[model samples]
Target: MPSTPEVNFFQEYWIDAWQRSILTLDVLRERGNAYVERSARTAPHVLSFAFEVVRDGRTLPRPVNYALVRIVPPQGTAIDSAKPPFVVVDPRAGHGPGIGGMKQESEVGVAVAAGHACYFIGFLSQPVPGQTIEDVCAAEAAFIEEVAGRHREAQGKPVIVANCQAGWQIMMMAAIRPDIVGPILLAGSPLSYWAGVRGRNPMRYLGGMLGGTWLTALAGDMGNGTFDGANLVANFESLNPANTYWEKPYQLYSKVDTEASRFLDFETWWGHPVLLNAGEMQWIADNLFVGNKLTSGEIRTSSGVRVDLRNIRSPIIVLCSWGDNITPPQQALGWITDLYGHEDEIVANGQTIVYTLHQTIGHLGIFVSGKIASREHAEFASCMEMIDLVPPGLYEAVIEEVNEGTERPDLVHGKYLMTLEARTLDNIRALGVNSDEDNQRFATVARVSEINQGLYRTIVQPAVQASASDRSAEMLREFHPNRLRFASFSDQNPLMGPVKGLAEQVRANRQPVSPDNPLLSLERAASAWISTCWEGYRQVRDAATEAIFLGTYGSPLLQSMVGLGTHHAPTERRVARDLIREADEAQLRIQLQQRFEVGGLPQAVLRALVYVRMVQRSVDERSFAMLQAIRDMQPLNDRMSLPELKACLKEQFLLLRLDEERAVRAIPRLLPESEAARRAGFEALLEMLGARGALPDEAARRLARVESLFGMNAQPAKVAHA
Candidate 1:
């Protein structure tokens, strides 16, 4: 063998050579073409572009015409009636709705496996003309109504899953029509719009840096009314130049022979941009992205009704990733920070909010990655009832693996069971310092965005609108810098086909780099060198950007523009003492002992159990189902209304006795006179049922018997006969 120094030098030389060759324009052309052809082939397998248009009486514009796709359950499968239906509303930010139910390994898929009836809220390539955000919300309400009608045969409310942009939209709908939806899971979404820390999230700075929403407006006018989706894709790519430029390409080139198809499929969606109406895009930037009004209780519908966060009473599960620079955990959890300001306020408001933060997963990974979808989303679907059982409060989801007779951490296909902790706002804040300065900075951005938007509409919009046409808009969409790269080289181009064929053949017989390969070793070293330089550059760039933004917009004059100097005056609304009186007259009480007993244990003993176990608050559906199962026990046969029967079963739940005397101790609490007091006590029993959660069909049927007894228009003769 050659001397060690000589061998090392030769390896380094070849690696440098390979890097230079790979970085050339020639290599990029061949690779880009290969990517497109492979994407053309694989796109069909991964994506189901087939969709049905949803029209609700209005003459919607062509651009807003959308398609609703139904996710069918498995063949020969029996669905559990207790499982709720899941409808995932995909982000219309750029790509279409299939993402929510793209494959058997997605959010929709996980829900289906857990026996949820899955449906997807997706739109077409062209939106209907004059389709405002309001129109879309109305359409969603109609869809829910249709789904509810279909599911009336089986009794369960639909659980809505909103991803990214869809999260806010679903929230707006849920706030307006809470009766239509059950529990809501807001995944990888940012609701408190103006929430983020400095340096960490630079994406929030893009609006101010680009001179606010004017550029979008100008683009919209140029599009004749529609905003091209390519712009959004470009914005996502620009976040990491190295990843966009070299790393993504090199990863494929290094594994080119194998990764060619996988790389292409992703890029096609990444490349195939969508469009939105001018009115819709502009509103998003102003109200959601910049104004940050939704979480603060300042957002309003076009009809002037205020959009209040507190009005949303459903259990909202917020899933976010710490590694997602786009919507950080801070942005995801910030709504809680903005709305309540304290944990007690959450409980007092009777809101149940649970959030989970993954240590390292990108924005897309939250939806696309199988590891995350199968484990996190699956676990969430499984524990939804348990989540519902959690008393109204703010809690941080904690997941840990169960170790059984082992010294090492147990891994089940690389997943672990999570133990959720009831947390205070201070615990969340301790994860990162949430200071007012950051809030102030975002406020300033919002103020500036408003000013800039006004100027654009007043000074520049008329000219652009007058000059714009449908043809010009189409031209702009095609020739957009982002689209140009893919369009010029796609299969549609005649010049690329032969070269693509030749490259496929080359790839067929091609050999790949291995640990023993000199070029492989050298390539790794070059990548490390490049990464270090990139990190340093990023740090410097961030520091400079912060300094510039603070100096320019952090001034007192601009701060006031953001409504910071002026505190929000509390609206004068007298508390309805009558409402309190009604509940009191309705016979509501703060009974600690009853609460304990309803939860499947005695008050003192349960508290002692909690104090001693110190594991997790045991809230399971099993015991509640057991109590429902007792309805089948001999000789308490009666049919009643479901709500009332559920209440009665709960009243009798703790009455189960090892002996006659033990059962006797609980009899008085199980029965009461005075119809309203009886109803109120029954309500407590139902609360326990809800807390205990879920029942077997036989148990459910027995419970149904109890419901039939108390059901409306019951015969007096029946009560006398009993």
Candidate 2:
């Protein structure tokens, strides 16, 4: 009785489905086991690298749970001790640290492969009792100092990788102690709290809808002084109802053969819940999320010192994605607009700010995705020094994949080419900015939050604090849906005890159905329909949430009650200018003009390169790489170190900014006296200019200007290269 083809397909689909059900449960059991195992450890993290503890923030003068650890490179990989070290500061929003180094294709891996020393900042499962965000920031400052001290022979200070929440944390540290850090990479971090388009980015509207952070305070109190991290993780999941509620589990059943391990790996991190102090959560809620105070210069340290973002001299590189509902491009880049009214303001402050926007990627994917690790993070590592030496200005970091036919592929590193093109504040605004009414509504939300928090303290605090006990808080945390979901199916549970054996038997006799199976096709269609339904619901929910928030917050009566009436205009909160800084910059500009006749061939070449950049609109790493190669050919003693080059470039750029014509007119003064020296420099300029394929008309014309300045009529720089 052999079965027909139709019967065979039908039977295959059902058998695979039956096996997948058991296998998916087994995968869940593994995730639960991982969660249970991690819970027993002192400082459990998801870092993919093996590292040794270096310094503990808990041991510092101001104790916190954070600690610094050096990532041990994989076997046979050699790290150059002289190169700038990389320190990745993990975000403690919910999950444990080590996220940036969670796989071989990650920030830490790229840094190691690029021959740089690497370190990571990780926190423990529980926050230090009574620990404030200030304490954490100060402790991180100590960690940076410790890392810097350990790498004294390094070319530059440690480049800090500030992931998500750690981005603002590192920014505050750099503001207070700007000298210790090198360049900073702000990966998916949000500085602007209230920047979002209407009908989208509904997360920002939650505070207003809920009448402020009173619920945050309530959660803290209910935790008996220890806020559970699961709550934050739950909010992240709620953003994507389809993925979180349906698709995630369904995908396991549909592709259990290949997706099980990945599912378990991700769930291992996502399921691990940590704890934060009640006061710490409240501080973040008040100061960062709802208050929108970081870039506004409204935050002050415990010692009453103002934390101004402009005080941060280190280069800030912001990496954000448009698809990230949590930290959209607006929140990631809007801080620049909030802090600086014009592009010249950033330049005047002597700050280098670079941002890169991905077309699509979720918030976690910014650090967790393998493609991001290999491309965006890789390009940043390859050109760390190049970015470090760029002049103080706002620029956009553009990374292009190196196609097979890419021009000047020799100049590129790995699979991508990195470039920094000058940009303006208008570029950021084009990403999607909130209107005046939107900002007004957010302001009213902040005011309403204050009012509600006051009322909560007066009315709700006594009852919650009195009834909450340490034992009950522990039980409450254990029962959180995030934890219960895992624990309920864990190996510890008697009901799931047979899943492991059944999954093993299924794997030993696997019978995956063909992709062409009709029943399987119908199943996929059903799944797609369910996902579509969930997506529709999410859109409607977000729309309703936005409408309610706007209607309530935009109400004149409510606004007046909260003290945000029509009299108050809606603009992003701005940092007040320091007149003293302005005067100092003015004097510096004068000093720069006087030094126009400084240095020899190197200075001449640098000025020419800056001229090329000024004239040509679109540029890439080809020219920058050529500059270093030309420098390398010079006498060992004559070659300037990276730090010295940074200083020179900054001077030349600022000088040109002050008066371009005057600066160009002064280039001849910096040229050498010897004919051979001048010729060598001129030839170097031609080489750098010709590094990219054939020079376009604008570039050729720009090179001709340099030629007139250099007094050379040698071979045309228009020489083309395939």
Candidate 3:
């Protein structure tokens, strides 16, 4: 090892180098200003960029404009029919479709490279007058129906990818029409709205800090009908003052020559904020963001049917990132904890849920980063089959690297394979820095929201709505601070014409600073230091806000005044079964019998072995071995001669409630000469006799007589052990 002094000398040298690399405050400010000007100039072109068009073969009664953007292939070549279909639903929060697939290496592009048929769910620039969320959902359903029809010629259902605002919306559509969805993937979406850890997940604190969403209502009314998208973008930017003030600008200045185009492209979308109708924004705030009614199983369609997530039969894949302060993994995964409370509940409900958490990817990166797209999204698209094969359960998606020499796909999109590990909701809860006490704070927020909304409607909404008009709305959109930047940069300004010429000249001779340059290094150091300081300031401000809010409003007296005294019921105890093991064994047997009737011996045995492995310690490997042995029998080939054996196995599985089709399928797995076949048949017969749910004694005897043909004797030791 090197001597301590030598190591210290190197460290000291690097520190000095870093100090020398810092950029002057003036230089940083200038760099940031240039980026803003450039971005503003390019805003229109970026916002107006069109998604490559695609035609759906399955048409609807009314024309639902559909597009197919070849995000990776660049729009001319045909896609392979064998690849799975990936459909990206852009958030309708304010902006439209394509954000999820804006770049060539975006979510859609990643799926296309992985051999998936890519589809974009893009809407018209204008929303239909009086259109409700239900109408939008119906349109989505029609789109899914069309996609599914086209995919009937291929294999597997289409994977629907929903981002941010679209996540909950797509989930709502899936909850109502599960048959249309294969596996649902949600990114940067928060389903458990009221769920957050104290002093963290500040976005959740936004609703409370704003004193409720009446300002949103007022804005919508003032705009005549629509809520400006600039407000939404402003809210997002407000999360980090350092980024809004210095860091983002400094980053552009540090790499101005190379990064200007990229910065302009993103700013185009960022500046081209869209609008949402008054009723739409109101509904979202009341039912989702603040009300927290959707996940509570309280949200219902206008037609009266309840929207329960458990009603969705399709697999759900939740992708969240730790670095996404906007929608933390806690917010993304907390719904599972809130909804089911445990893994057993999920399994019992026959739902397969898989969640993957990226340690460092930010919110936008979950949908926009090519690296994330190639690895995380690609693995998910490639492994739908493997995931489907995973029997109904709750699992954490674990990614692992494979050797380059292995028989992996050539040019694998990702460097790793997606694997599933059984997980309980408690496991998810542990990842969150939340307590039940923290959730109590949300109850207070919700109560305050209701009162504020009521107060606004009663005291202020009438006047706000009465004075609004379409012209005013347009003017409002034009003058908004977020939009003003773009407007001021446009060709409409006389100064912009000169600035544009200068920008072009700068582009020609821009002597971009090198990453290795000492000055560039110093700029980065300074930016980091500033960001750290800003973060500390933000933390203290938030702490003080939270302290004040809790001190006065969190008290029982104020909680009562705010109508927040509706006591939370004590959490119910988990049911503890008497003879739990025996019951589980019996249940397993019946489930197997049902599967034997429906699928076959191989499937039935495989399922039983799964449960056997799950319930019994040290039995997993053995049960899996048995499953393989059963699969290798090729019982289908000798079904005619092994009818008796087949009947026996069928009966045993029926006792387990495995499904009738499985029993019939298993008929072929038991060969005439196999000794194990006879024993398997015998056990199946006993299961059938015991599983007759409501048969009379005489009827039971008759069934038992039929089962006796295969000897309904259980190995006494096995029954006792069970």
Candidate 4:
């Protein structure tokens, strides 16, 4: 054959490289084709799991494009209906819905495999006409209500896993109707938009760089009252041009054979852009991004109800990563410091805030990475029931892989076990936050945005609408660069029609070079060189952006012009203390003190758990497991549901907080006088707190004090079954 005639090492290298180039182009073609096919589907979600439609938001009182679907458990997986259902709300930031369940190993997958009834909140490609962000929030609440109604027999309300954009949306809904929602896991949700470090987080400076949300309103006007999501996706891509423009495509080119499937799968979702109403995007831009009003209590419902983050009654579990430049731990957690001056305020409001920080996962990895799903998310599923029953205060979630030293390995469901350690507001502050000056800079941006938006509505918006027609808007969206890049490479292009057949032929006679080939290594080095250059460019661009933003917005002239007289961010921007809530808190503390000694073994066990937790030595889920065992031993009707367990735990924790000395002294009174009954509980609880090595004196003294209080000796017994 012609190829056999030139069978040499150099020739092989040359042939392989050429073949790979074709294959890479072909892969892109396939990806483009997939985008087209997905767009044509009736319901084009990328969820690997099959699901049944529950309720359509289009049919709701306030119409929207969202739909709630119940995921069918995968084969060999059994769902327990009595357990609370897990509802995953997808983000509509840019791409189409289903990032949370795109793969088999995802949030929905974990919940389904764990035997929980799982539901997905997905949306149509287009928003319903005249729908606003408020309408979407209302629709979500109705969906949650429907989910709750379906699971009336469940021991707990539905656990909501809100992803990215959905994180803030679901929080708004939960704040309004916490009764329908259960514990909420906000994965990669940026609640405090203005929270970031100076040199590191450059995205927050974008609003100022663009002169505020005027561009957002212009984009919507150009689209005939709808905003193309491709713009949002383009902004995300602009963050790392090296990865977006080169590394991602080169990855497919370098390993086209094995990576094609995965590349296409991801692009299937990322390539298909959705649409949002102009009003919807404007509200999000004004209130959340540039305005940073979500946590500031400035955003209210259409009916005049305040959608306060502090009003969310469910447990708020924040999952973010240090590597996530998009939604860093600061943005995810800064709201705590914004709302509460001290940790006691969180407790006073009956709020349980748990945050988990990952060391090196990117923003997408927080949901899409299989490793994260297997570890952090898996652990959350295992501990969510316990999470519901934990005290109302701030806590840090620590998930450790099951090692040899891990106690009660049998109790752990998967490869990891999760522990919730009590944390203070200062701990959250330790993870760098915006200073007063930084806050003013952002507040300046918000003010300028308001002015710019008003000017556009007054001067330019009408003219833009007058000239823009539906046909022109559709044409503009069709030719959007993000969408065109993919569409231009598909079969619709006459030039790409032959790529399919040529690629098929190349596959038949494929000659992949050996891994150690010197020429291939040279090619890899060249690709890496190009990637580094792009990365350097991005750094320079980011630096310039930061310099321009800080210089422009930090001007005292601008501050005074914005009506910030003292050049200080208004104190009222921080959550103002509600006099009514302060009175309720005072009454709450008094109520907690009165319930010093609650009834029954469950109440006694909860009190002990809170007491050991206060010491913060090493009491963990093993103690929580023991609590479950005790519940199992109780009579059917006598056993508490999640709501009752939560009430008992909060009461016990508050009792300890109001008066620890009295609460501890009365522990014996709460427990049964029967020596065997109390001893079993003590042994079960103490087994978890005992140190493997020599215990610290403080921990040891607390241990001794607790043992004495429980009427047991210093030597802790083996963990006895309930």
Off by over 4 Å in 3: 1-78, 404-414, 504-526, 566-601, 604-722
> Per-residue lDDT tens digits of candidate 1, residues 68-122?
4466666755566656677778888876446766666788778887777767777
Q: Which candidate model has the greater TM-score, 1 or 3?
A: 1
Q: How far is candidate 1 from the true structure (C-alpha RMSD, Å)?
A: 9.7
TM-score versus the correct structure, for each prediction:
0.76, 0.97, 0.75, 0.95
Better of 1 and 4 by lDDT: 4
In angstroms, the error of model 3 at 117 is 1.3
Report the alpha-carbon TM-score of model 1 versus the true structure: 0.76
Q: Model 2, which residues run further than 4 Å from truth?
A: 1-7, 713-722
Candidate 4 lDDT for residue 134: 85
Per-residue lDDT tens digits for candidate 2, residues 354-402, read 8999999999999899999889998898789888888888889888778
Which candidate number maximizes lDDT? 2
Give me candidate 3's TM-score against the actual structure: 0.75
Residue 284 local lDDT, model 2: 91
Residue 628 accuracy (lDDT) in model 1:
40
Cand. 3 Cα-lDDT: 0.62
On lDDT, the stronger of 2 and 3 is 2
Q: lDDT by residue for model 4 over 1-722, one digit each (tens)?
A: 35553356678798988899889889989888887887787668888888899999999988999999989888889888878999998999888888889887899988888889999999999889999888888899888888989989898999999989999999988888877889999999999999888778888988888889999999999999999999999998989899999999889888998999989888988999999998899889888899888888887887898878888888999999999989888898998998999898898899989998999999999989999888888788878888888878888988877799875677666777777888888999999978777787888898999999899999999999999989999999889999999988989899998888889999999999988777788899999999999999989999999888888887889888988757353534578767877898888777766678658766776677667557652335666776677677767897787678878878887787788888888887888879898887776566444422234555566666777878887565342321
Candidate 4: segments with Cα more than 4 A from true spot: 1-7, 565-573, 617-619, 671-722
Cα RMSD, each candidate: 9.7, 1.8, 10.4, 2.9
